[model samples]
Target: MMAADETSARLTAVLDKVRALGPTLRERALEAERAGRHSDETIADIDATGAFEIGSPAEFGGYEFSVRQQLDVVTEVAKWDGSCGWTVWAGASTNWIPAGSGARVVEEVYKPEWVGPRVAGSSHFPASRGRAKRVEGGWQLSGGPWTFGSDALWAPFTNLGCIADDGEGPYLVGAQVPLGELRFLDDWHVAGMRATGSVSCKLAADELFVPDHRCVDFRDITGGNLDNGLKGSLWQAPSLGWSFSLMAGMSIGIAQGALERFLERSAGRPIRGTTYKNQLEAPLTHLMLAEFHSKVQSATLMTRANAEETDRLGVLAAAGTPADPDYMQRFSARVLVETAYAAKWCAEAVELLQRNSGSTAIMDFEPIQRAWRDARVVTLHGALNLEALSENYGRLMAGVQPHNFAGITTLDRFAPTAPNKAV
Candidate 1:
């Protein structure tokens, strides 16, 4: 392991590279949204920052930075542009998946000479998922046009999910397939996050062969059990924990960026029908800004705390002292609930600022409006919805059974016994 001081220095250097792109990311925010994807120039600019390597294995030439450091980088990128930050989240978070598939698959996926991100991934939404059947040496994958294939266009490979039957019943499996074997659709139209290019995709044929080594049980990925023989704290962390934790940073960045732009645009502007010549001079404006500022700060604190705990658990796991089942369930629950809350708070903050920005703020060219839309979309994500997550957390706190699967509401082995004893 590197010394603490060296790690900090390396993190700072990576941050500096991404920080310098803030202006460029902000400048292109509108263009990317209009194009329904990032421009080639913008994509190359971000790739050059080395930010996407934060979650990859260091053995494969990736930085594999700690959870906290990775969150910091994502938050900073988001402060410039939501789409750019989101793209980083997709690329960086999925890089860890190949690690769990073991060495043979990892070797093929994480080539040292790869110039940009190594992978993109499909969303967990079941409606757009595909199907697979176990076959000799691999699975025959079919029935896709997987929706929400984020960052797939530029990635070398995409880890796609499919429903597979193992005799008794059906289960989800993830297969890492080369980008060339799939087709992307231009169907990402939406009210927010329009530039993420999270479009639908399908196999080039009715059946594409995915070698068994490249496919893994979805459970192992979330449990942090897919080992590629790396000895880093990051590889030991739960995949969902790292993914949602870093995603919370995007919410923070978008909220922070919206506030910055609001202040800049409101400087000398009047409250049209009010007596104040400048909105900043109004007491109401002061109160509104303070409220959102508090929300953003609170959300950031929650996100950072969860990230630290994730790293601590990873360290323990690496040392052969994995967290107890009950504790692991609680940790997983906290990460999920906290992530949802952060999304809620950040989205609310942006919405409040957008509302107070007056009529002109709704113009197509206004970045604050874009931030507002993007923030809303983040909250609306199925996995990150505040109401659904809050209900699950409340159930856990009340000792009621969770309504969803383990790793989402609780870890499988650690699910509380006597769930109905509380109610």
Candidate 2:
């Protein structure tokens, strides 16, 4: 592992670089949205910052930074451009999943010269209208119409999720395929996060052969099967907790950006209908801004605490002392619930600021409006469904384990526990 001081220095340097690019990212945000993807210059500039390597395996020229480090980088980037931050987050999220797939899989995914994220994935099986069949050497995968292929445009490989049965029963599996082998659909049209280029992806051929080395069990990915000989304290981190932290960072950053923009644009502006010559002087303006600031501060604190705890547990695991299974489960459940709340608070803050920014704030060129849209779309994510997470947390608090994985955490529940019942 890199020395702690060295890691901290590197993180500070990278953050400084990203902060320097703030104006450029903000300048290109509107253009990225209009073009349905980030500009080449924008991508290259971010790649230059080495932000994408935050979650990749350190053995493969990656940073392998802690979850908090990753969060800070992502939040800083997001404060300037939500889409760029989101793309980096998606890349970071995908790297850790396959980093433990085995040496061969890791080697194949992370090339020495890869400038962007080593991999981008569209592995949400529930949204995948496809299949996988167990073949002689590996699996013959046929899946498609996988939605939300974030950061796929610049990644060298894309991970595809499928349901496969190997005699005993069915299971969720992810296959790493070269980007060239996958076909992308131009279906990314959306109200927000348009620049993420989260288009749908499909197999270019009817079925493709993916050797066993290129595939991993979804259960293993979620459960942290680091016995693959990889040596990073981060590899032992809670998978769901780490992933949710990225989203929370992005949410808080966007809200913070919106607040900054509101303050900038509202300066010395007339109240229009009121006698106040400067809206900033209005008592209502102070109230709204204070509430927004308070909410963002609260979300930031919760997210940081979650990230720190994740890192602490990871370090313990790396030292060969694993957290108790029950405690880990409860910790993961709490992280999920807290993440949802953070996203909610951030979204509300952005909306509050946007609504008070006046009718001109809705213009496409206004950063505040974009932040509002991006924050809303983020909150609408399936995994961040506040109600469901709240219910599960409640159940856990009441001494009842979660009935389903819900993509939050997977612990020994790989196969179907009961016969499939028609919904």
lDDT tens digits by residue: candidate 2, 94-189: 666676577777777774677776778775554456578877998898857777888888888887777777788777777788888888899999
Residues 241-322 of candidate 1 have per-residue lDDT tens digits of: 7878888999999999999999998998899778988998999999999999899999999999988888888888888887
Location of the lowest summed lDDT over 10 successive residues in candidate 2: 414-423
Cα lDDT over the full model 1: 0.81
What residue runs in model 2 are displaced by over 4 Å at the alpha carbon? 405-423
What TM-score quantifies how close candidate 2 is to the native fold?
0.94
Clashing pairs in 1: 100-226, 145-201
Please report, in order, the local distance difference test score of every candidate based on alpha carbons: 0.81, 0.81
Off by over 4 Å in 1: 123-128, 406-423
> How accurate locally is residue 103 in candidate 1, as Cα lDDT from 0 to 100?
81
